[model samples]
Each structure stands twice: as structure tokens, then as C-alpha cells.
Target: MENNTWSDDQPIVSIQNVHKSFGALEVLKGVSLDVMKGEVICIIGPSGSGKSTLIRCINALNDIQAGSIKVEGLEVHDSKLDQLELRKRVGMVFQQYNLFPHKTALENVMMAPIKVLKQPKDEVEKRARALIEKVRLQGKEDAYPGELSGGQQQRVAIARSLAMNPDVMLFDEVTAALDPETVKEVLVTIKDLAEEGMTCILVTHEMGFAREIADHIYFTDRGVIVEHGPPDTFFDNASDPRTREFLSQIL
Candidate 1:
């Protein structure tokens, strides 16, 4: 299930005129965007604005009722799409640190590669340890989730996502749950990943971080993208009044 069809010119993730709903409530309406390889796209908006839903759609965690989402040239909602294969290509980190309580940090990172991908234990362990270190948790590998702070647990979660070696990473307000003092560490780790050219799309409230790291920023509101542009222009001279109003409150 390698992605041989994707190319440098093609977007890694493409959402075209996408529409989504939860039972009777429509959450996303005709949204469209494209993320190129190694580009960091930051999505910002008020709560209930479909920021999270849009990213979830990209990974097929939430099915779209209309429009299309393509990742590496494969339709995300296609009937024949391989769920496991799609997950391997598009890694995601959620707001909550969903690490296994019983497993140590290293084991949590190693679990998926061994259980799902069927990689050998020795190889998985080696990579998991490196990933733990990559998230700056080298010494805490043996600690259980309960033994770690929120930031540490979140870093472990990020490392766990990296274990799969995804081509694109979707972050859904990953720092929203962390304490103020601890948020910087988790953000620094993500910043490092983006700088290293891992294609990243994030739904975040950290305006400062988004401004500093994102190649482009999209302001989504009420299920639609009000405006989007390069970080400097978006922050300095927002064209849409809706975007400007949103920025006024948050920034």
C-alpha cells in the first residue's frame, strides 16, 4: 500500500468542497484546502468552528457526507480504502493523551508498530526508544502514563504517532490540555518536527506559535474558511471582517 502515485507537485492532503454533519447538525460546509509536502498549515478559529472536524475528516476518523478528501492520491472515504494503511500514512495526535495506562512510555510507543504493523520487537523497541528521545523524553521511557505530567504524556503521545513514520501529521489542539508552564515543551517538540519538514496540519489556539511556525494560516468559522494566507499577511492585514474580528478577540 505504498503511495507511488503521489508526486512533488501534488498536495499530500486535499479537501475539496467538503461537507460534514453529525446527525442533524452540519459541522462543515463546503470547505476546501490543500496541504503540500512539508508545509505546515495552522487552522485557527473559535470553538465549534469545525477546525477539529476538518482535520478528522482528512484521516477518515469522521466520514464526510459530501465532497472529497484525498491523501496521497487515494480517496479517504472510498469504500475500498484500507483504514490501517491510511492511518499509517496520516498520523494524528489528539488533545487528550491517550497512552495506555498499563504500558510504560517506551512500550506505548512500541505497541502499534508491533501489534498492527507486525514489525519485530527488537526493531520496534529501537525505533520507539529513538522516538521517545526525539520528543525529549529519553529518560522517562520506563515511566507509566500515570507517573508522568500532562506535558510528558503528551510528548509520549506525539512520539507514539511518530512511530508509524507518517507522511503527514494532524494535530488537534494537542496543547489545549497542558498546564500553562508545560505547554511550551510540547509546542517546542512540534515546532522541531515542522522545521524538519514533516508535513503538518494543526488545529490550534496558540496564535503566537501558529504565527511563528506555520507556512500558512487558515481562519475557519461556522464551518467555513473565512480567510487564509501566509502567516505574516494573515496576522498583520486580515482581509475579511470575520477573520479580523476573530483575530481581534484571540490575538
Candidate 2:
């Protein structure tokens, strides 16, 4: 798969023997993974399993203590220029929907494209409006963050990320904080992205969604990936006992 160009070209992102620690706690230990273009890979595990941290490291949100991370052939360690450019290509959606409280939905989506990408103001507004409509928040473009429901706020967050036109999207438990009724709306937005061939790496506990959407499943325990395979193999026939134990509790 690694050699074939059309289907198995160089991975969009690669992490090799990655390690990270905070004081006495070592969060990631020799973790490695590859994310190919247009493939959706889901990471599932218990809290404190380092799933979020692993995703954060890929976009350099969390610095790694050891190992190498490459995004689109550029190494992502100890280089400010490369890291800055790498982040522009990788968009992240967080659990909390970190939209600026002061900005309206439309402005929030336009900020990065205008400031960082140097897009013309008129063009940025046009794209932002289209993205807001795409996420089904058309009439709420002028709504403040406080005015929208959790689902609407999250949809705005997703639109803001998409406004950048990223090559890879990382979703870090994006539905974790939403109400049960609101969760489906966000998940539906994600489902649409998957159907559109977006390359996504998701860290989530929604096993049903993972089963339906993930091309590959990764089981992480204590900061290490114990098993990884196609969803059928990983969910039904995982070789590791730990993977089975985890699935039994959730599935």
C-alpha cells in the first residue's frame, strides 16, 4: 500500500516512534501512525489514553519530546517556519468549539483567511458565507456565539475550520460536550465531510459513528496503539486481548 502512487502514495501525515511527557507522566510512548490522503482513521479509547494528545501533536498543538512527525513531506519538529506552514494545511476541530466570543459566526470564519491567507475582504466574506451555508447555518451568519445552540455553535466551528481549505482535518472528540440531541447534528456534518472524501483523523468514543465512518480503527491504551486494522478486523477480530476488552465495554 505504501508504494502504490494512485491509492498508496505518500501519506498526508506520518508519526514515527513519537513520545511525549508532562512532568512525571509520560503520555505518548513510541506511538506511530500514518494517515493517507482521503482516508478516515478513528482513534478510540478511555480517558487519559492520550488520543487527544496524539492528534494535537500532529498539528503541533502539543510539542513532542521524542520522534519525528511529517506533514506533506515537511518534518514537524524544532522548526518554526515548517511548523507554521504545516498548521495552515492542517485544520483542527476541538470538543469545546473554540470560536472567538467577540466575533460573530461569519467574522470568526473569515478571520484566518483574511489575516493569514491574505485573501481579499470581499472574497473572504463570500467564502465564509458559503461555508456557513454548507454547515447549515445560513441564516445564523450574524449570530453571536452566545446566541447559538451548542449544535449551531459547533457547526459554526466546523465551518470556520473548513474556511481555511485544509488538506487534512483533525477532530478531537468534537461532540463530547454537546447535548445528546445536539450531537447528531455535528456528527451528520462530519458524515458529510467523510462522504466528500475529506482526510480526517478523529479521536472519539462514539463507537457507532466510528463503525459507520472509519476506514481504519486504532485502539489506544496508556498512550500506545495496541491494535490497528480495518474496522471489521479491529472491531470483530482484534488480536489483542486489551482491544477486545475495550470493545466489550463500549460495543
Give the number of the best model, judged by TM-score: 1
User: What's the C-alpha lDDT at position 121 in model 2?
Assistant: 97
Q: Least lDDT summed over 10 consecutive residues: which range in candidate 1? A: 1-10
lDDT to native, each model: 0.94, 0.91
The best candidate by lDDT is 1
Model 2 per-residue lDDT tens digits across residues 1-251: 23324333888888999999988899999999998999999999989999999999988889899999887776777565455577788999999999999999999999999998899999999999999998989999989999999999999999999998988999999999999999999999999999999999999989999989999999999999999999988888989998989889988
Instruction: Mark the 10 consecutive residues where model 2 has the least summed lDDT.
Output: 1-10
Estimated TM-score for each candidate: 0.98, 0.95
lDDT of 1 by residue, 86-136 (tens): 999999998998889999999999999999999999999999998988999
Error of 1 at 185 (Å): 0.2
Task: Give the count of colliding residue pairs in each prediction.
Answer: 0, 0
